[model samples]
Target: MTDKKQPRTPGAELPDHPKFLWDSPEPKRSYDVVIVGGGGHGLATAHYLVKNHGITNVAVVERGWLAGGNMARNTTIIRSNYLWDESAGIYEHALKLWEGLEDDLEYPILFSQRGVLNLAHTLQDVRDSRRRVEANKLNGVDAEWVDAATVKEICPLVNISADIRYPVLGATYQPRAGIAKHDYVAWGFARKAAEAGVHLIQDTEVTGFLTDGDRVTGIRTNRGDIAAGRVALAAAGHTSVLTDSLGIRVPIQSHPLQALVSELLEPVHPTVVMSNAVHVYVSQAHKGELVMGAGVDSYNGYGQRGAFHIIERQMAAAVELFPVFARAHLLRTWAGIVDVTPDASPIVGVTPYENLFLNCGWGTGGFKATPGLGEAYAHTVATGEPHPLIAPFSLDRFVTGRLVDEHGAAAVAH
Candidate 1:
């Protein structure tokens, strides 16, 4: 008999969800804090605001269905192996929070800490990987520079032969890196935030801002004007749409980043794998689907779908890296709009408007930073002062020339 195993029914063993997760509330006339965008970041911010600071008069406004934006479309790979100290500080904090998030949120997020291997294919890649490993270690993150043999041992499916176009020479391994169920994480945060009296307003688009002499008083939405003492923007790629009307120019550009998944099968892949030079990252979901993604498209757009050529390149790189994925049938493919910055680092601090705080420009790294960013951002909103963790990402860095440039230093190229 053939050694191949039979395929399981698709989505048969996925996590179960509650029938009614949260209440759909109409937007109040005013709130102590109004968060634009009800995705993972927005929900997490609301959750922390109530749990940590006892500020329950919060509202999360979503233009579409809850958590249906990038939160629903990402690859879900979470890691803290960044090169810069600021990035390491924030992402490592997020990883620690992720370790206990299920207990804290009182919900199952399916966070599998199976580790991540960022492959190095060239001499420069090897050098960069080794340096990043040292940087991660200095920042108190668990990272090591593993040779080709170690990489193969960690992920046997990886192709490290010399005949390939881009052979894997080595990699930087983070033992604590992993993936999570994106939707469940979002819903868990939403449930806890809603239970604490934060309003979950869906289908309410924020059309403009209500301003009073450089201070953003509230938001003007299609539903109605909702006044707020503080407004925090967590709207991923569409942040510029609202910021432009207020004549606040943030250095961000939107692009389409796509991802796809394979048909459900028995678990074969054991850990998350990413290759920056080849521009493909792979991880097998807890439900058995092989999830894969690549860098953003060349052009800038707000579209939620990418060009066919972009998907083609991504698949080509994936198949070359893991030959077993060649026969797997593609289940679905989609994209998310990502906001990239000049320094390739997130901007998370006060804006020109006194009452408005900006937390956008995460690009492909947003989902990994959900809880960490939320805790820091919530502190910024509650007290109108930037948290110590987020103080380096202030918008003024663009002018001060102290930017945290992670253009090629990050694990993935945005």
Candidate 2:
């Protein structure tokens, strides 16, 4: 129930944390736009609101420290191999932005394109993986189906022998998929947005909305009521809590998702690997620690921690798959609240209120879609219309029965 203060890497020196990136400014009485949540998504949205839409009057309000929530907790796996076309459209756009994000932000994000392998254990897994590969190909996203032998060659640490339970049959390979320094990504966005004269308001909790006849005129924060021409909700897991006060029911359920890291070791994991059947995905950090994660908890709650049983099962599957990780020491474990939808897809676009926009239900894909969602959602909020890439992800999709169900497809469930 407690974590001891231990060294990040045994007998090795670690650098000091970077200097403060952005200023914490007081909220103004009014602005052109106000974005709730100061995590990666909200910061990215603010950046694009200035760069893409030429809207500089923006404020990103965060209750806690910026990027201290899921942005800091996720395992940092970035990929665009989803089975659905709508997912491909938005995520692939984000991946393209990720490719040039460092240059765009003028910061070092350490975005490594090491690659990713989604292992298939059963016959059905192989079939579904192959189908997803083809779907990704049709969407112009780089992907290929590889046999178990290829999986072993790509990651020698993997135990592909048939003697082990749920032996690896094959996998879906995406060479462009990789991981990045998540904290740096968030800071880069925040810094850029701040330089553009946008306000980064921290420690300001939004209690409710200031509405006039169903039009959201502004937000009521603990500090004061800040007026806005438009409001966008990028408040990930706690989005439902904000919308609930207005009686706008979104099809979202919040759950706790956990991830852990091992004590720093020599570089062994060269690429990211994931398994839906075994309920574990893993990669190695730039600092040489093995990073791993699991699925969401079954229950719905706002807590930022998960049950220990989930961690136990995650480690069991991880050891059987890698074998080399069996002796590694668990460095630390933490969790984040994720807002999931019934179809396992995101909700982005117009809301019942004319001046209000909604962007949530991204679940585990929020980190990967940060830039793309920000750009598209900024356009939607500025122009009062959905962006072409995010049109299919509108809130009305649930009523129209046009859900982009990645859960049923078992494609990139992480």
TM-score on alpha carbons, each prediction? 0.96, 0.95
Report the C-alpha displacement of residue 30, candidate 2, in angstroms.
0.3
Which tens-of-lDDT digit does each residue in 1-414 have in candidate 2? 112112123234433546876788878999999999999999999999999989999999999999998899888888888889998999899989888898999886777787889999999988888999999999999999999999999999999999887899999998888888898899899999999999999999999999999899999999989999999999988998999999999989998888889998887888889988787888888888899887888888878775689889989989988998999999889889889988888999999997999999989889988888989988898899999999999999889898888894333344
Model 2: residues with Cα > 4 Å off, grouped in runs = 1-18, 408-413
Query: Which 10 residues in a row give candidate 2 its minimum summed lDDT?
Result: 1-10
CA lDDT of every candidate: 0.89, 0.87
Model 2 residue 278 lDDT score: 80
lDDT of 1 by residue, 49-104 (tens): 99889999999999999999999989898888899999999998988898889899
- Model 1 regions lying over 4 Å from their true place: 1-16, 409-414
User: Best by TM-score, which number?
Assistant: 1
- Candidate 1, residue 119: how far the Cα is off, in Å: 0.5
